[model samples]
Target: MKENVALIGWIATVMTGVVAPALILALIWKTPDTLLRTGEAGQFVSATASVGGFFSSDITTVQSTTGSIAVYNTFSAPRNQLLVVRETLKNGLQLCAENKPDTCVGLAGSWAGDMKPVPHARHRFAGLVTGIGNSGASLWLLIGILVSVGATGILAQHVDREGRRRS
Candidate 1:
């Protein structure tokens, strides 16, 4: 019985350390290309102009970096109206805007909003915007794997002690 318990524990430990991490990396690798997208929309404004009014529609993109969401306005041209951008993350929110008059160039809006910083919400796998959620899931999976490996190591030691005591 002790031998069986020890073997089971050892298998679990090895699975966590070896199989788990590999599975995570594999999932990340298998993640589709659309998971990462780049285009003019996501680029920084070359210059600033005046926006007529508050923009109702906003452009957003997911970056390669985990937990980072890029948001921007289609009105790239700067206008007199100040374009307030906000980004909400898991921790908190961030604010940024394109001040008028001067060209609002080089403003890569990711995870930022106009009013309040867009709160970072867990990504949903189902829907049109799966990339962001998929990335988030992948990140969480990796973290879980790491935690599992650590726990496995600690449990392995306990199992070994029990095995020794029984013998």
Candidate 2:
């Protein structure tokens, strides 16, 4: 009866320590960091776009009282032409121009109250941003799992030996 109990305990300890650790390591090994980063970036872009879309109709006109000379004017053309230009500018700013360090800093400092400096802030779906965030989280989780598994494996071996001795 004592031997049976010891054997059961030993098996349980192995499962808790050895198998669990192995599973964690396997998961970590399967998920690469770059893949996670890509996913996170995608998610962030998606979420930003989704929320941006909701507020698209609520366009706020910025009246520049400071009299900055404009380099380009869409107002000189028809409404459709102006719309196309605006769309193009928005896309360009969101994807390419926004990431430039000088532009980012300048815009962030220049923008008025409650305005976030998103160089690439354009309306789109939330999938990209959510995916990116999830991927990053997954990578962190994998790292945590790896560390936990390593510690638990050591503990399990110790417990297994102790159980064997008792048996």
Candidate 3:
């Protein structure tokens, strides 16, 4: 019985400490930093999460009081929230995604954002945010480490019992 328990412990240690991590690394090795694909229910093709918790770009968010503006949260990460400008330009200003005749205000501006990060925030609204506010890689790594600790504890309990018997 003691031998069997020790063998199980060694097996668990090897599996948790080596094999499992190696498998995870292999699975993620070929994964791309950015992905774009449509959803199953006739959704738009979008760039998937980039490395870390941020997207491949930092989307800017703006708020104005003199007029109404559209709200769009591009990168859904923590630190993804960049410049939040609430300008009150006197001109009947309109910020468009594109430049065309009489479309976007051709005025001097700054703080157009793009480029990804590990994320440190979410959309100001509650419904737009999800997950534990961390990257999947970090979550998985944490899980793996926790499981490994549990396995080690199990092995240690049995080994301690066996040692007491010897003494």
* Best of the candidates, TM-score: 3
Candidate 1, residues 1-167, lDDT tens digits: the string is 75567567667765755565566446545544231211222323333233334744344432321232343343333323234332222212222333332322223433332243224444322222433334455565676667677766766787788878879
CA lDDT for candidate 1? 0.42
Stretches off by above 4 angstroms in model 1 are: 1-134
Q: Across residues 14-41, which tens digit of lDDT does each residue of candidate 2 receive? A: 5654555455445444443221100000
The reply for model 2, stretches above 4 Å from the true place, is 1-132
How many clashes in each structure?
21, 23, 7
Q: What is the TM-score of each candidate against the true structure?
A: 0.32, 0.25, 0.34
- Across 61-106, the per-residue lDDT of candidate 3 in tens digits comes to 3332222223232322222122222211122122332212122321
> What lDDT would each prediction earn against the true structure?
0.42, 0.32, 0.38
Weakest 10 consecutive residues, lDDT, candidate 3? 35-44
Q: What pairs collide in candidate 3?
A: 57-115, 58-115, 78-120, 78-121, 79-119, 79-120, 79-121
TM-score for model 1? 0.32
In angstroms, give how far residue 157 of model 2 lies from its true place.
0.3
Q: Is candidate 2 or candidate 3 better by TM-score?
A: 3
Predicted structure 3: lDDT: 0.38
